[model samples]
Target: MIFFDTIGTMAIGSRLRMLSERITEDARQVYELYGVGLKPKWFPVFYVLSQNNEKSITEIAKEIGHSHPSVSKIVREMSKDGIISEEKDKNDGRKNNIKLTSKGKSLALKMENQCFDVKSAVDDILVQTKHNMWNAIGEFEFLLDDKSLLKRVIEQKKKRESYNVEIIPYEEKYKQTFRQLNEEWINHYFKMEEADRKALEHPKEYILDKGGHILIALYKNKAVGVCALIKMNESEYDFELAKMAVSSEAKGKGIGWVLGKAIIEKSRSLNAKKIYLESNTVLTPAINLYQKLGFKKIVGHPTPYERCNIQMELNLG
Candidate 1:
């Protein structure tokens, strides 16, 4: 019985893999009956080499639609079994060329049209279905040239995950998100003091109203991360990059990277000269990211937050 058989089309991939495995095993049985020591997986490589004279490993691999490593492994096994010969190319000694041995050549001649036999059987069975399996497979292969099935599937998943995340300007609704995201980290490692509360509670009055910019990261239209660039030193176009956080549940989806880029772009747009950030040594992941984005550790900078230990600055000039 097929597990998940009820899912039908949703389980096509598993069904295809299972079907391939079953057909491959049956082909192995056919080879045994013919007294040919061959595995279905080795068919492509062996058949390609049989048709070509002393082809290089890479040439055979590409023609057979297998990786060089996979072809190499099969070649090694075939060479050990005395069915194929491997040697340095006559013209280019650096390249390894492969060819069917006398034994392999004999089998190839005997097995001529044998590969077609299995296909013909499958085709006969598929005749009962309204759909043409060969034509469908050919179309599927054509589509694969544009994009592999695995790649398209992975990209779709990433798109779905990314669709849930969006970075936007600060709003009244997100005042609490900024507080909760930041507080989650602060409360875990250090106590939230008066300075933290004042900024978190009255962001519009204290931060945004002072020509500062704040950004919020939304996941499914809900705030999950937040960061602020507070304008500083009236004469100097310096901005303090502070109060950045990604929610515990939303961490590690490149959300922190997205927020950092947004803040940097906003600071640049505001004609800022430099961005300084203060953090603790324990937040290594955040620090590493900051460093990757050209933030350098600097000494002698004073910070009001008691929890702050490490100071880093990014020169936008």
Candidate 2:
């Protein structure tokens, strides 16, 4: 019986491997149609260029975890193909800077589109092959590892029990809690004068009067996190998911992601065309979570919130 079970498992694994190879081949064909010569090895070069422009060969090599000689050879081939250009750095004569050419930029865009299509196709296939298999696999991996998934589940349960938070439209009673939470955030990170803190804590009456709504996350009937959605104009929506403060006692309880998802759902329900947020780069975990949730980085805006070093945006409509 054990031998038969082992043989069946091996057969299933072999079939899955063959299917994956077929998917890869299909993806390559799609790339070729776009006139882009994409290969597994060339990905490192593109990944470095995507992050920052005009990086030195040494910097690119370091970022991609390749030896300098290997990267130099690849760059030489890429340059000969008219995909990248190399120039001597003016300030550092010994260093060579690599920049993507027009062809390279076009290829990058095409590759992105093709990759998205391939992902969609694979997702559809998996959905059809076995219902809820992805979720089951994810849970299995979580269990096999350091029990991270189980830990997250336990944390979520605790949060649910302690918070029992409800999402509601802006109300006068929430103003005091919002102010208090905002102050707590400022104190936790930014050192500001009493008057300055008070100024920020003072809710903008104009925003409230102009059809703005706030969502507060509460624990034991005490406000813990807050997000605001403001109508920018007749046809536009602006969101300030700020004042998102979780009580120190409730830290590491997955409250942030929950609140973030709730805020996004609320924004969509309100027919928001776009949602914008201001944050600091020092909070890497928060930034990563935002990225995972489909937020994209944007330039800093001219706003009164000077402490907000990072800006992110999401398009709903």
Candidate 3:
């Protein structure tokens, strides 16, 4: 069996590179067949200059989504071949405006016609195949634009490492662990206020007895995170998500996200319509996690803690 076949989807980058090389080879042949005076790689820069008449290397890079250095390298090669010429920018003396030569403009007209035939051939191949590769590539690029491949892979890595983490209901044995986690984060940033002391010191009396719920995340039988859902009496929100904290050791293991999700599910199970939260902008990661859980910033809410500068709510209904 082939090495790529053995690796399956792991060879996606290699497979796409191979496919691109094949298409580029065909482009070279097509250019020769039409007797067009343009290199296969020069078509992009040539086409851009044909339409815009003038552009700087930075503009070309932004338009084609290539790196500045790569575009500069291509521009240098095209200039050496007499396909493009550079003139100093009228407004910016330091920048050079790139435009096509007379010979390049003539080649552009021929390549434009060549493109129509190549497009038709691609369409024919699309019809012959079960799936449309063009549309598939567009959709895949759209997804990558929304969330990069690096971020997606990091999330998967977090999930794999957090598979052993278990979320469990509050118990007497975990009371101290809960306080320790919350206090570690609180004292690291702001002073522990009276409201925080009341809730953390007497969670059973201040939170649990008031119909609130606490959850603890256990990693390898060691408690690493905690969150509380305090049942609210307000008309708009049914619960207030509070007292959420994760151990510094388990920071990137997705413990906060998992604890947050479990708390949200608990609120939903309790027939909550909206869940509210109060936070400070200094806690950027926490705020980001809330947003990822569909929470939106809200205003005009009073808070007992001095550190509460921002409020958000998630509408489950």
lDDT digits (tens) for residues 189-277 of candidate 2: 88655534543455566456666666777655666777666556643336656556666766665667777888889778777778877
For lDDT, candidate 1 versus 3, the one ahead is 3
Runs with alpha carbons beyond 4 Å of true place in candidate 2: 1-163, 192-201, 233-237
CA deviation > 4 Å runs, candidate 1: 141-222, 226-317
Encode model 1's per-residue lDDT on 1-317: one tens digit a residue.
Answer: 45666677768788889889998888889998777878778888888888878788899888878898998999999999898998887788799888999999998987867767877888788998899887998998899999998877765664567667888999898887888888999999899988788789899887889888899988888788899988776534388888999988876566787789889999888888889988988988899889978899887876788988898889999
Clashes of each: 0, 0, 0
Between 1 and 2, whose TM-score is larger? 1
Clashing pairs in 2: none
Give a tens-digit lDDT track for model 3, residues 57-129: 9999999888999899999999998989999999999999999998788788777778899889999999999
What TM-score does prediction 3 earn? 0.81
lDDT of each: 0.85, 0.72, 0.91
TM values, all candidates? 0.56, 0.48, 0.81
Best by TM-score: 3
Which of 2 and 3 is ahead in lDDT? Answer: 3
